[model samples]
Target: MHGKLTPGLDFLSDGGEMGALMRAHDWSTSPLGLPERWPQSLRTVVSLMLTSKFPMFIAWGPELAFLYNDGYRPIFGAKHPHALGLPFRQVWSEIWADIEPLVKKALAGEATYHEDLHLVMERNGYPEDTWYTFSYSPVRDETGGIAGMFCACTETTQEVRSRAALKEEQDRLRELFKQAPSFMAMLSGRDHVFELVNDAYLQLVGHRRDIIGKPVREALPEVEGQGFFELLDRVYATGEPFTGSSVRVGLQRKPGSPVEERVVDLVYQPVTDREGNVRGIFAEGYDVTERVQAEKSLRESEARFRNLADHAPVMVWVTEPDAICTYLSRSWYEFTGQTPETGLGFGWLGAVHPDDRAWSAEVFRDANAKREPFRLEYRLRRADGTYRWAIDAAAPRFGSDGSFLGFVGSVLDIGDRKEVEERLRESEAAFRTVTNATPALVWVSSNDGNIVYLNERWYEFTGQRMDEAVGSGWTAAIHPDDLGRILPYWQRCRETGEIYEGEARYRRHDGEYCWHAFRAVPQTGSDGTIERWFGICVDINERKRWEEHQRLLINELNHRVKNTLAIVQAMAAQSLRQVGDGSRPELQAFQDRLFALARAHDVLTRENWEGAELREIIHEVVEPYLRQSTRHFEIEGPRLRLIPRTALAIAMAIHELATNAAKYGALSVPSGCVVIAWTLVPDATPRLVLRWQEQNGPPVAPPTRRGFGTRLIERSLAQDLGGEVRLTYDLAGVVCVMDVPLSDEGGMLEHQSSH
Candidate 1:
């Protein structure tokens, strides 16, 4: 029905570009015929539509021939040129069901309007989610009968999606504010209007529910005269943040309650808009009332006590129940030249001769734990850093109600008496002869705890003369780090008059440090006063190393157990996702892999998990299947050892291959067989090559897609053993090849084990 067409009619001539396309278009392939035969109303409507700039489309006749203006052409996307004259239903078949009702309504002379309507369309090659706001109206004929529909549309996808995203972000912000731990609120404008308030802020203000739209002055009127109002005004005018630490404020926490005093650490930060103009304030703070009150009470108590102790002749001190020094009298500070701040909380220990501090702290802590009165003598550091002997006595104090409070102590200087004892110890010639004859190193100290003598063995082992090893000079032979700990314990034992036993690393005559156990016993006079101390040193280095090695082995075992459990967890999680509940083929396959791993572990465990022989791993995995069928498998490989990780990976791979053969390849047939072999390639870096080839099975072809077995073989071997694997489905058989690095832990153990 091809013919030359003339277009001189009023409607045809008036129609713009689309009208020209419809008139010149071929109608043979369409349900609608030539334009000359189209209804008068349809031609008139198309003529008016093509000249309009607004997006508009028309569907004409019972067949609903589609027509659109140039402004609406982009709505067709890639469907352009051909969509102009096509039936409306076919042109937009993907969304035809969604829009057909609206088209029918318009044809019935009932107009419809939609705002932000959701639609999924495939105007292009692929479907897209789209939103539109449009109106549909009926087009009339000369007989005043509705023939078709007209649409004026506007796309609203971007606007609608942007609004939804903005709302979601606002909700997220509100949730964050509501759950914040600190009291937080947003105040807007110069009046500090409460724009938003979080739960913590509401609780802070005594749970007042109606405070959100009110100014801070109206919501919290009690804070007006507390200087907080002034602070807010200053911040709003200058747009600078204000921070207050432990600031006192008066507040009415409830509707009809008396004003209460509270302390708070607060900050008022300014929030700015896109233009960099500050618009509102963000208030954040935490209440510190209890901490502030406790500190105030402690200061008052310390002031009253210092007045009485400052002029006391003896040094005085006080400690908390935990043995942390809380206060020291003026006499004690003057004697040690340490400030109250430095002397508090175990800090005063720094003034003790470094060697004696450790032992003194231990004795003091022990006495406090038993809550008993005790007396001890130790060297203390004078203001000039000279060590002086001092005797200290302390008694635990309790309240009138018998509740344990803390300890109160006093100290007396005893350096003068210690000098007299040193001269008496020097006159004892018989004591030196007996100690010098012993093989052990020996030393003696005076009543004042100063070293007075070193035996011949002591001088020989330390590579020092008697003079150099006497007094505090012997500390030079003690390792620097060990001296800090050992000196304190030795001094404590001397002061407490207890048997001293301690360990230290002492520098030997050869310049190497070795551990030694030192023991000392005090000889006291009839008056119960210590006259001298006798000590001996013995080597104990070998025992220390043996203990350290045992610890390392136990830690390594724990790490391996944790790693194995994690691997099992990952395998179970993946298997459960694929198979779900009940027994299925996927579940059975996972069980086989799990059992293969267990058998590999059993072989390694038998060897203490250091490693296992490679042949053992293969035999364990394949033995079960080989015993069940008449088919046989040829196994041959060098006797190489495999570390725990490499052994497990190989075991799993072998199990997968054997199972596949049983299901669809070699082992499925009576005459089928499998050959497994491996060889070692030696060099600076050795490698192991393993091959699995099936034979005498049904003709094989490569699978169309990968299965679970293929993925496992490829991923596990590469990750666990750092190996490469290639699986090929040959026409006559299925073959697999693998290459793995050979580490010292997985090197050859013996010759081939063939079966």
Candidate 2:
């Protein structure tokens, strides 16, 4: 064996094995120790392999003493040392359990060769199932009987487990891919033919179920020119995954119509083999039409918001949670003369007025910490180094995760408005001071009659506080008797926007009513609308009392003057009667005429010399002389008004005429009738024409006496009223006519008649 072996073999054997092998190359030194460098177990196994045709192993009792060269070290691993001399049951208990029956059968002299035997054994910590064409032949001793069994085996664990795992993984992938909601498919080769298609893919492409294994273009002839086939080819050739979001694809049916397209998100993954060569393409996609449209609309909405913020009159800004300015509109730069970058961080604080810096910072800090909206008014330093009032407001912004991201805010310049407010305050203060200093009560009321403002004088006078005086309650202090009249006037002023002046009594602080001359003037705006009313009330109680006393005194003087006139008329009548001829009848007539004049004066005085009713004057002066049956009189006229002087003159004239008629005309006969009719003349000169007509009496004639009766009628009517009187006595009757102006004896009566 050594001579036949090459140098490579000699090196494997070693020097001691070569020497021993040369001495007893055939008999003394057997093939067992010829390869002395090898272990006894391997040398014995190799020597047996020359005779054994089958792969085999030799074991002593329970220990496997020798295994064939076909068995690699991998089969034993760390169990090699223990298996060389240990009992087979102890060394490989798990394997012994399966081989024990076979070993026993072989030992009973029944030669056995098990073909394609399946055995499960433990190698190291792993349980391995192996397939083997095994032969266990009895190694007979010199008697040619069974001594020990030889075993031959092969492992098939890798092929069996690999086939099983591959089948399981393929089944799992198929089930998962089919159940997916999204469209999925495998395209084979550069032609992009569909090798596999899930249910979702078939549904998406509107394909029949049986066409799944067919090429996509062949199955759906409608999709020939579509871009999707080309896209798949590119992905396959490149051996790279392709992704598309919302890639539109038009259907082939109607090329000119509105394109029927779907927004889809697609991904193509290249399937590769063990050699890293691209084989097929796997595509997964979803319909994202609604989501794509919604995203577009959201972007448009954000654009609109940006436009509004940019163009708004106020300065708009956004800041981060750390108070760093993130955004500022153009208005901010225009107003503050500071760009957004200049105002980043706490740089915006520099623009704040020195007086308002501390307050602004405090408010900013508090709002940021608490994540609340902030609103405050402060002054900001302008480009001109002047400070202007500004209203700053900010609302905190938050992220979807409830983090305080930042804030959105606005700044409005109110400098002009602030100046106007200050001026208004100064004016109001001055008005209040002036009104309070005055002795008269002053108030300002709304157009609706609500008291909006009042001076101290009003409160002092009413014994009420400012609260009580405001609104309609201010009227509570007004005397009840005057409220009716004053309230109407006040309302009129409000409606007409006029000045109101009236005298009324108002209650004082001491619960006494005092006469006050109240005046209110409505204040109007440029549009001619009444906004409010400013009023003043002065105390007039003392003056009113004095005027009342003066009126009484005047009335007494008028009475005395009337009495004196009556006496003068009486004295003149007596004196005339004495100086006249001894015609007793004429003397008596003269006395009667004087008496009539005296009676008229008395009637006028009774009316306070104001005026007298025409009918009343006629009845009073005539009833004393004429019996009801002997004289009949009628008075007819519209209700007419006469001035005091005109009424007196008319009354006296009527008395004189009635006296003469009673003495010498109509009243002397039972058939007599007298009619007194007066009509108002409508003209610039308003006059009253009165006629005293008598009839059915003895022959009538004018009085020859030229006595006081005739003179009195003529003078009273003509001198006092700028008119004339005529008396005529005829055979048929006597008639007297009087015409007078409506005024004091002149055309001034026209103006007087207006009253």
Candidate 3:
């Protein structure tokens, strides 16, 4: 069978893959018989497929033997090499039910055409969805009778899927346009005619059915004069987008309805073609009427506040949230003499005193950072080149949403009041100095007897810490023996607001018990209520001992009186021999010495000779001179004690100095003044230094000769008291200095160290 075919009968010589496969195939056992016996119509179709670039297939004879061109090989998938010369039904049996009618119509001599036809094919071994645009035409025999079917087809599977995907996308876009929350509309043409609108857009325009195909101005005529129509026209003509916020619009829903005003935020975006020609516009917007109205109301309220602040009395100011000044009241400008250009922002800091600017700025910035209120006092430079104290108080401002806005503040000048407060502090300091120097322990309490203040002497004497001794804590420092009764009496005084005088034993820091006379007086306020209690605890231990000694002295008084009388008789005999008249200088001098001795005895008698306060002895000696002159005198020192022998010597020395001062030194002149001060130097051996300085007196020459007072002050005082005394008489005035050792803890000097 292979050797029988001649070249002229060969049907598979021209086509590529399909023709080659057909030639090499065994056709003797096929239904079409041999290639040479095939009909002329089939041969003609085969000749067309072989030379054509398009894909084509033919079926011929009774069994309709299948044939296709090389361009059709891919359409068969994996069945190409084996499908040659097979019957059409056998070759495509999987889709035979779908294609048999189309093939039969062509064989009956009728033509058919299908575009993008759907088919399920298994040419590659498994079923697949496929499509094609093809035509089935009848092939005639030489006698004009239908013989076979011919098909010219192109697979359109990709185009079918693309159209389906495009349809799905269009459906989604239509849904989005209809169901959108904001107002949206589509316009077409240069006339800006409305083509499509969603539900929101319909409601916004107050139109239900009459808007499509109508121009924007004709559909919503009330918006014609509101510039919205003009805006759409501009976007269409220029192909540029326009956006606006809080745009005013008026709408009338029906022919007879009144127009209503509305505010909207909107945009008109042009839709253009690939060549950049403008088509129409896409409109999108939202209603913003409520927000716009609210902002208007807030602006009105702010105006009212500004007016009030402008006329306020104090210096009022406002600042940004970052503490930059934004506004200042008229009073502030007048006070600082600054213009807006110089006072705005941080420039106002220049009005603050140079020393206080850094501190004031720090405090202000810190409060601003925390968004808190604050108060501060600082000096501000006023217009007159003077600095005045100002109290600046400010509070942070916040919005309704609780966000920090800024600060509103005021300043008040307090220069006069501040001066008064400073003076009060100075007065209190002076009072404290006097109380601290006193030997007696002093305390002050509230009307209810809660201790509020204690002098330095009180702390030193009791060895109590300040923090531990205030209020009720002072009770712990009282001697246990005396507190039992003293507490009851103290309560009585506090209740009745009466003067209290009592005796008690107080414990010293050294753990020694001493008798003290406690006295307290209530000071009343203007309302006749007790303001405070001032109390002093004076040491009276010596007085107590003196009383005890006087009892024993009663028996010895007679004997001592006889000895004193005999010594006085001898002294009188010597005075009578030295001067005949009682007015003589020697007699008067002797009497003055005797009187000085007596005054010393008087001080010792008051102290029971245990000790005498050195200050008291000095006061007694100078009392006469102090009474005769109006000179100012200052006496300052801690309280000190003197033994009987030392007290007598110091008393004599003071009397002689006073006598000389009255005659020729500070006391003799109206302008003269005296300052007597003493201090105790604590050491392994303590020493007390007493200085009496006089000023503003007549010039003195060291004294032409040593007078009796000078001799006593320089020689007798130093020898008798075992101390050193120096008397200087120069141009200014007289100055006397005494240095003596103190033993027994400020009691008396066992020896003197001269300097």
Q: What is the lDDT of residue 635 in candidate 1?
A: 94
Candidate 1 residue spans exceeding 4 A from truth: 1-6, 9-24, 180-182, 186-193, 233-241, 254-261, 268-282, 286-755
User: What is candidate 2's CA lDDT for residue 455?
Assistant: 86
Ranking by TM-score: 2, 3, 1
Clashes of each: 3, 5, 0
Instruction: Give the winner by TM-score.
Output: 2
Across residues 434-529, which tens digit of lDDT does each residue of candidate 3 receive? 999899999999988889999998788888899988888888777787788888888887888868778887777898878888888999999999
Residue pairs in clash, model 2: 59-65, 62-88, 721-745, 722-745, 743-749
* Candidate 2 structure quality by residue, lDDT tens digits, 521-612: 88888998888889899999999898777667656776676577668756766777689855456656655655665566566556555566
* C-alpha lDDT (0 to 100) for residue 607 of candidate 3: 62
Give the true-structure RMSD of model 3.
32.9
- Cand. 1 Cα-lDDT: 0.82
**Candidate 2 worst ten-residue window by lDDT:** 746-755
